[model samples]
Target: MTLGLIGRNAGRLLVPLIFIFGFYIVVHGHITPGGGFQGGAVIATGVALLLVSYYYRDCLERFIPITNFKLVESAGLMLYICTALAGIVVGSGLLFNWLNASGGLFGHPVAYGVNPGDLFTAGTIPILNFAIGIEVFGALSVVTLIMFAGLQEKTQQEEDAEAAESAAPLVSKRKKGKGGRK
Candidate 1:
């Protein structure tokens, strides 16, 4: 089959996979090479696919409403700031590690092994990764939606203009044919 057909047919399957992979990268960021930024960008790819395949005018207005995007983006930023501030409260410098407790809730080890080099050894890194992930995802998704909305609006306006131009000449011709009385 052609590439176009494959892309269209597989988009439904591929989009979810992209989201899962992006989440995996974000969650395991501190342990591996991937991080929030990478994961958020990856997730954005899924959103992009949806935007490309569907009519985003309604979807953008409904799911990614401008007001909602603004709110989520602001909340993500505040959460990141508060998380960083938490480091200072715990006697560690900004974005410091191991100032409070390592790992997630319940004192579970963030990484494997007892040493700092382990996958879960990083203290605040994972939290930081999560915070950055939310922020980046919100910001990028909002930006994408905004751009898509703008493009759609512009295209619609152009289509309206073209239709009006085509109809205007036809109307004028008809009027002239009718002796220009009306």
Candidate 2:
């Protein structure tokens, strides 16, 4: 059985907040202690919590489809690769920080010493951060969901087997007179 009502309700409330925190970590990765990988892991944990709080069939079919996760994972990887190739296309080295201090999107000069952070100053780092975040979130969530599904299936199979075994009639191994067959 899945988590009870209280756990489900708590998970419902917490999932959105967890996702928001994950995004925040990804967005501020260049200046903050957390980044895409960390944020994605957090998001995956939230997904796992939600998954565990509900029936696998109910949740898997209605919310977390494996196909969707696969698509998201692929898309994130493509985005990351494309972003890196963009630099190469512009005659810069692969994964180069050409956007830094270029007076363009996500381009801004940073002060030499410690100072307030600027969200737009990290160039391709933030983009990479987001890409990696999406990839990791999808990958981890899918893994967890699939693992849970497998466990559920195994449990159901075992329960069915037990029930069948119990329902089957018992057979006598010995005759009434074992020493002398009747």
Candidate 3:
């Protein structure tokens, strides 16, 4: 069940924008302050919006297919691990910047003095950020889906009824024996 028409419409409009912002944060993580974890959180928030805006079944049919989330998470983890290992194998040590100042991918030689932001100079950092973003997004989205999906949200009346039932005094069902002494 959707929150309402306004919520549904807003979610429809904003989900895509949220995804774009998340991707932006992930891609520019090396240069900007936002990084993989932050980006992944943002993306998960987008998924959350969809969940609250629509039913889980609707979301699965219209927005996302949950089966692939684990694969995405695994792929992200493997990419991160492989990248780190590649540093040890190809470069000097673990997590070493394999393309630093080498005139290749992200290898532009940074000037000695104050330098403007260079997108291609950060190299492996960007790759790591991407991997982390993918992993986090998948994991968090799956968690959110599992927690909320297919569960009936209790209405206010239902909650009140439940509370009243629990609060009511207990009464004996069995008949009293020997002048209610037993």
RMSD vs true structure, all candidates: 7.5, 9.3, 11.0
In terms of lDDT, the poorest run of 10 residues in model 1 is 98-107
- Reference-based lDDT, residue 128, model 1: 75
Q: Please list the residue runs of candidate 2 whose C-alpha ends up more than 4 Å from where it truly belongs after superposition.
A: 153-182
The whole-model C-alpha lDDT of candidate 1 against the native structure comes to: 0.70
Better candidate number, 2 or 3, judged by TM-score? 2
Please give the TM-score that candidate 1 achieves against the real structure: 0.67
Q: After superposition, how far is residue 83 of candidate 3 from its true place, in Å?
A: 0.6
Q: Which ten residues in a row have the lowest lDDT in candidate 2?
A: 173-182
- Model 3 residue runs over 4 Å out of place are 61-63, 112-114, 150-182
lDDT of 3 by residue, 38-148 (tens): 999999999899888876664464456776887888999999999999999999999998878878988887766566678887779889999999999999988888777
Tens digits of per-residue lDDT, candidate 1, 30-136, equal: 66789999998898888778777545653446666767866866876787898788768874577666433444552354444554544444566677787787778
Error of 3 at 93 (Å): 2.4
The TM-scores of all predictions, comma-separated, are 0.67, 0.81, 0.77
